[model samples]
Target: MIQGFVKTPEVQALLDRASGKTVEGGDDRLKAITRDLVESLMATIVKYDVTESEFWSSIKFFQDGAREFGLIVPGLGLEHFMDLYMDAKDKEAGQSGGTPRTIEGPLYVEGAPLVEGDVDLSDDPDETGTLYMTGQIKGPEGESPDGAILHVWHANSQGFYSHFDPTGAQTPFNNRRRIKIGSDGRYSFHSKMPNGYSVPPGGSTETLLKAIGRHGNRPAHVHFFVEAPGYRALTTQINFGDDPFAKDDFAFATREGLLPVPQRQGDSAYVAFDFELQRSASSDDEVFSARSRAAA
Candidate 1:
């Protein structure tokens, strides 16, 4: 017999393991998913005549990217891919007319201060240009829903998120908050216009981008998460109209309806945006609201 490293047996074994096509024959769902993936990957390897060295080098790149993998996911549009799949499923289920879901970037911090209407989020009093954000949560039937929890956060002017940005470590949970909806499903907050952030320099996330000749910059935006008893929780973001990169977002997260016209009110922006939630039809739909983080 040829060595274990020989190509034919190794390839067949890989396909069997990935497709779960052994005599054991277990887990139909997993096998179906893995079979497609392994088959496509094998086709690419064969068609491109990828060398062993090149394959392992790419694997090493991913291993290094794992250090800051969260930062890399959105850039690759994988996060948005999840949103697209969800949107398609919702459409198939006749679930329509809610705030379009967007990528929930990886910087959400659990347990921010829970407050009532209108709390200032600026860490510095001297922070300029306040943002007055107000919105109501409407149910799938288009009626206001009570007792919805809204979690919101964004980067500061310097393009860094607290707890994630090294320079922002001291400001853990800075500019982040959780607000409870009132009886009318109305919620509001006071904040400075959060600026956009760029991928960290010298990090694997940026290194991958640079290698591909792409700029890794996200436009200024605010993230929102909401969950109600009978409605699906929603996670979305809105981009500032004037951000240079707003229209050319590297992450492909923007939707036409998401950009709101900013009204100026004495060095502050007054934004009135509303969210509509879809009625949960299945446990999978309900999980959308409960799970924001990806699995390990």
Candidate 2:
């Protein structure tokens, strides 16, 4: 037999265990999922013609990524899984449709400019594009929530973000601002029209996409992180309806009701949307503070 390092006892033991399991109902389901995962892993190994060193290097990459997965799952769109589960639980509890929630994205920098009332978010009007977003924050039964705070951010026209962009002098944290709602729970801001941007061409995200022959384009959208005293913290994005890639976001974040209609006027446009927050019987103050810290 041709001896390969992979034929070691450890792998053999795993294979033996996998074979010995007599798959039942739940086991059958698990096997199906495991098969997909294992097949994908094997396909990747073969496609790259990965060597032992390269294989281990990729493993380390995944290990590091796994460590960050907790943060990424919430910030990078996978929180949709929790949303799905929550929807099911809500339906079982007779809760109907409410404002849709979405991924917050990875660019939210804390300590953003805070405005108790509506204000212009385009601090650098010329450098940053122009966008006028208007919306309301409602509680159950469409009632306005008092003192709801809206934290928002977006990418620049060049698709470069603040802190991530090498040209930091032009825009420190491109398109990041926090606007608080008034007693009426209504809010609006004026900013530039952000453009669609891709991930770094040679980074891990790009590398995986390229290997899979997938494009790394994200549709033009705004990020929102909303927090109110007694409501659950909501992290979401609003995709511009006209964006060609809006429905085909590489991040896979587009949701049924998350896309907003944008009406163009003069050189810019207005995007109107509303978010309904779920109120918990027990206060979520601690949860909100923890989320704020994580964003910080």
Task: Give TM-scores for every candidate, taking all chains together and pairing residue i with residue i.
Answer: 0.87, 0.73
Clashes of each: 0, 4
The lDDT leader among the candidates is 1
Local accuracy of candidate 1 as per-residue lDDT tens digits, 101-214: 998878788778888877777665435587888878888676877668888888876777777667544366668888888778888788766777788889898899999999
Q: What are the runs in model 2 whose C-alpha is more than 4 Å off?
A: 1-54, 60-79, 92-95, 125-129, 170-174, 285-296
| Residues 36-125 of candidate 2: C-alpha lDDT, one tens digit per residue | 566566556656667899988878766756634433344345666766776788789876655776665556677777776666665554
Local lDDT at 36 for model 2? 58
Question: Which 10 consecutive positions of candidate 2 have the poorest summed lDDT?
Answer: 285-294
- In model 1, pairs of residues that clash are none
lDDT of each: 0.78, 0.70
Residue runs of model 1 more than 4 Å from their true location after superposition: 1-13, 23-26, 124-127, 265-267, 282-284, 287-296
Q: Scored by Cα lDDT, where does model 1 land?
A: 0.78
